[model samples]
Target: MKNKIEISDLQVHYRDTSALNKVSFDVHENEILGIIGPAQSGKTTLLKVINRTLEFVPEASMDGTVKLDGVDISTMGDIYGLRRRIGMVLPLPVGLPLSIYDNVAFAPRAAGLRSKSQLDELVERCLQQAALWDEVKDRLSTLGTKLSGGQQQRLTIARALSHQPEVLCLDEFSIAIDPVTTMRIEEVLKTLQKEMTILLVTNLVQQAKRLATRTAFFLNGDLIEIDSTDVIFSDTPAQQATYDYINGTFG
Candidate 1:
């Protein structure tokens, strides 16, 4: 498989504390890459770095290179264009103060899409992709924040999909949702991976096993191991720490 993203000697620091240290990895195109780790393990930080959002932090400093499609992201002139290519969904659903239809249409509109018919089609398609269309089809005008937690999460996913990103980065997306709803979104992700490369930062190990083509284990600013999901979840991984973490023996 060809690499969609490449990270080389990447390091992220917040003042005197390190978030990630000399991390190196490649994300294959059109594959779901699961990132599993405990709290403060820098899984979220890695996603931010990939999308160049880490630069938003006043105290954060980064070293090394992150390339998208072999082009270094740091040298990219269009920050907005770059972000649009990498959609992000955070742990909590941050619904905009807009209607469901408007929420999904926002990004496309900002990118200069104006035709009502085109916006309508894009909104419906994105919602369908998120597995939320059937649930909210009749309620497009309702405020997105008025939806249930799981529904709002799905709406956020729909909004992220509006731009048709090449890469989708989800940071603990299922954390606030119920199991059934999480399963529904997981199915959506399975379908989406065929179109876009996915970087999934998840605390749930089983979720990774179910969705990720390959999995990476992170611990205390270190990348412990990365391999096929089968190998990572099996009795033998390249690293004992990976096995321990996967088996619930340790984090």
Candidate 2:
């Protein structure tokens, strides 16, 4: 299997403190790799680095390399093009203040799609992919900001997918949602996995086990182990730290 993305000796430093330390991993095509750890354990930082947003923060200095689809994004000319290909959904749902229809169409329009019919088709297609079209189609003119928290989050995912990105990075996707809504989002992600690579950050072990093809453990900003979900969950390690964490001795 071809590795869709690879990170080597990855480190992120904020001035004097290191937020990520010597992280390395491969995200295979069409698979979900859960970056799991407690809060402030670098899981979100890892996602930011993978999605290339860490560069946006001026205080962050990254060391080592990250390659996506055999190309180093650092050497790319069009950062927007790269970003469009590898989309990200942050912890918070972000949408324009415009109508829900316009929110989904924003990316395609900015990329130069002008035909109203084409944009309309794109919006529906994406919202359907996000599992939100059925609920919002009748209210296209409504403001996206007016959506409920879970609805807004699904809309954000739709917006990311509208660009036909090859990879989707999500940070804390189900954190603020009710159980039913979280399940709905998970179902959408399950279906989309065939069309996109997924890198997720989740503190919920059950969610990680249910959604990810593989799981990577992050502790004190370090990657301890990465393997298939079953292996990670079923294998007994001699090191008590890993076993203890898995068995609920500690996070």
Candidate 3:
């Protein structure tokens, strides 16, 4: 598989604190790359950098190379375009204070898709992709925040898909969802892998094993090892820390 995104000797710092140190990895096209680590492991920071959200942080700086489709994102002329190509679903469900239909249609509308028929089709398709259409299809005019926690999380995913992004970055999407809904979303992700690359950052080791084609382990802001999911969870790994972390010894 071709590399959709790549990082080399990447380092990020917020003021005097280091968030990531000399990290390097590749996110292959049409594959789910799982990132597993404990809190403050730089998992979220990595996603923010890929989508260019890290630029918004005060005192945050980076030194390294990050490429998207063989092009250096740092030299890209359009910040909006870079972000539009990468959709992000954060841990919390932050639904827009708008109608469910409008929430799903927001991205396309912002992108200048004004045709009602086109917006309708886009909304339905994205919602269905997030496994949320049937439940909210009839209540398109209802407020998005009125939905349950699980529904709201799925709605966030649907909204992210509204732009039809080339890459989807999910940061602990299952945290707010029930196990049944998490399983459902996992299935949805498998289907989505056929259409776009997925970057999944989750603390759930088992979830990574169940979904990711390849897994990368991070600790103390360093990429310890990246390999097939099976190998990362096996009796031996490239790093003893990785083996220890996966075996429930310590995060």
Candidate 4:
């Protein structure tokens, strides 16, 4: 498969604390690359760096190159365009104050999609993909934040799919949702991988094993190892730390 994203000797820092230490990896096109690690291991930091949203953190600084389709994202003139190309879903479900329909339609509308018919079709499609269409179809006019936590999380996913991004970055997406809802979204992600590359930052090792084409393990700002999911979860891995962590010996 072709490389969709390339990170070379990437390093990130927050004030005096190092977040990512000379990390490097390639995300393959239409594959779900799972990032597994314990807390403060830099998984979320890595995602923010990829999408260039790390700039929003006042004390954050970065080094090295992050390229999307062979072009360095830092050199890209249109930040908004870059962001639209990579959709992000955070751990907590953050719903816009707008109605369910408007929340899903927000990004497309901002991109100048003015036709109501087109927006309607796009909204329904995204919602269906998120496994939330049937639940909220009759209540599209209701505020998005009014939905239950699980429903709101699905809404977040639907909104992320609104612009048809080339890369979808989900950081602990199931953290705030129930198992059934998480499983539903996981199924949605499996279908979505046919269309876009996915960066799944999950603490759940089994979740990665179930979905990721390949898995990378990070520890205290270091990339311990990366390998096919089976190998990473097997009796042996390139790094003992990876095997240990996967087996729950230590995180």
**lDDT by residue for model 2 (12-66), tens:** 8988888889998899999998877767778888778766788889999998889
- Which residue ranges in model 2 land beyond 4 Å of their true spot? 235-239
lDDT of 2: 0.85
Can you tell me which runs of candidate 3 are displaced by over 4 Å? none
- 1-251: candidate 1 lDDT, tens digit per residue: 89999999999999999999999999999999999999988998999988889989999999999999999999999999999999999999999999999999999999999999999999999998888899999989999999998889888989999999999999999978889878888998998989999999999999999999999999999899999999999998999899899889986
How far off is residue 85 in model 1, in Å? 0.3
The runs of at least 3 residues in candidate 1 whose Cα sits more than 4 Å from the true structure, single-residue gaps closed, are none
lDDT of each: 0.93, 0.85, 0.93, 0.94
* Residue pairs with backbone atoms closer than 3 Å in model 4 (clashes): none
The TM-scores of all predictions, comma-separated, are 0.98, 0.95, 0.98, 0.99
lDDT of 3 by residue, 162-243 (tens): 8999999999999999998799889999999999999999999999999999999999899989999989988988899999
For candidate 4, lDDT tens digit of each residue in 95-205? 999999999999999888999999999999999998899999999999999999888988999999999999999999998888987898899899999999999999999
- When sorted by lDDT, best at the front, the candidate numbers are 4, 1, 3, 2
What TM value does model 4 have? 0.99
Best by TM-score: 4
How close to the true structure is residue 163 of candidate 4, measured as C-alpha lDDT?
Answer: 97
Better of 1 and 4 by TM-score: 4
Candidate 3 lDDT (Cα, 0 to 1): 0.93
